[model samples]
Target: MALLETLSVLSGVGGLSFGAYQYYRAKSDEKRKQELNDLADELNDLRRDIDGIVETFQSPTTKVDLSHQLDYCTKDVLAYKHETGDNALVKAEKSNGGEKVSNAGQALDLYKNGDTYPRYHLTLESGYTGYESNLVYAVSDHAVYINHLYKTLDKLQERHKGTLEEFSPGLYDGIEGLMDDFVEDTYTNILSHRDGIKVNPDSHNNIEEMGRFLFFYFWHYEGITKELESLSQLSDKIEEARTTILQASY
Candidate 1:
């Protein structure tokens, strides 16, 4: 009778121990899920940043850069003392000709050999020493980066409809983007995107798989976030340069 009673008590103790273990595991799993959820939250933040940059940067950058290019000439102009001597000669009434100069080609009155002696061969103040201080080149690079980023990320968002990431191409997709993103044609120092090509893009393969989306979500997402952040910073810098150009133009 004593052994039987002891066995019953032991049984109850064992069941409580198991219950505690199960509760601990449940709490651990919940913590892990929240951690994984943070990854998604970070990616969403990057997407919003990318979209905001694309919206604000694209059209205005083009207009500002284009206007700067066409309106500001670096050629030798008859830099005579006008009423107000400013660097940029955009939209002015020429002293040589009473006609108003509305564009950049008209800004710098080209030096004629017989006419002016102290002709100034002006370099655009925007560039560092010999370069122009415009947003054209930097904006070009930014365009490529951000454009691909937008399309790729947008597609990723569409494909990542939650179910283990099956819909989109694998991140290691193909050569189509490789050429424009870069091509190692010169073989100079062997700088190449050799590794990225090895990854999945929904493109490079034919076999339909279920895990490619999640693979990128888990692995490539952080790198992508970094890229978007860099682009955002670049966009702001470009905008500042654009503002400088505008101020100089006037």
Candidate 2:
């Protein structure tokens, strides 16, 4: 009778243990499913935010704003460069008039020898009239602008790297390519124009090209702004996912 009682108790304990194990497994599975659902929701939210940004870019109002920004940046760079020469001239005159009058005058005389009077003395000149002129600044500005746009595209690419595998991978991939193209074209144009600017600052053709390119490049800001909106949406979605995951603990 004692043996029988002992066997019954053991059986009961084993059944309870098995039941507990099943209960825990179900709970864990539920938790995992909730977490996944949360992640999906967050991704969707991110997608919406991104869509909103893109929509804004498409809006005329936003385009106008971008236009203004581009104009300001171009104007600032050009104005700065243009005045650089004048500033240099003024300084040269003042210094020459003072203690180094004789030396300064001699340098001026040497510089004024040709139409390209300051070719050799460009180093001493106040502005970017020499080989290392502010022309480089202009080039760098354009290049940097292009790079800035490219960086946004890069961000999109990074996000899509692992996360978009289950969703619309093809669409995201295409968008990434488009962004890359925009960056590449802008960079190419900048380089081409820079070469032109360096080779002939006074060439009517080159000057016109430079102006056109600058204007066009300014428009890229609009695209970048739009891309940023999309990225923001994606971030929001990610946040939503995290929140959902945390709340699903029970």
TM-scores across all candidates?
Answer: 0.31, 0.35
> Superposing all C-alpha atoms, what RMSD in Å does each candidate have to the true structure?
23.4, 16.0
Which is the leading candidate under TM-score? Answer: 2
Off by over 4 Å in 2: 1-7, 30-38, 41-68, 74-186, 195-215, 218-250
Q: What digit string (tens of lDDT, one per residue) describes model 1 on residues 1-250? A: 9999999999999999999999999998776555444434434443444455444333322345422332233121112112124332211111222233332222122111112211111122232224454212111222233334444444434543342122123321221232222211211111121122111222324211212221222123223444445555544543443344333323
Indicate the residue-level lDDT of 68 in model 2.
47
Worst 10 residues of 1 by lDDT: 111-120
Cα lDDT, all candidates: 0.32, 0.40
Candidate that would win on lDDT: 2
Candidate 1 accuracy as lDDT: 0.32
lDDT of 2: 0.40
- Give the per-residue Cα lDDT of candidate 2 at 40: 55
What digit string (tens of lDDT, one per residue) describes model 2 on residues 65-139? 434433433343444456563322110112111122233233233222212111100012214434453221111
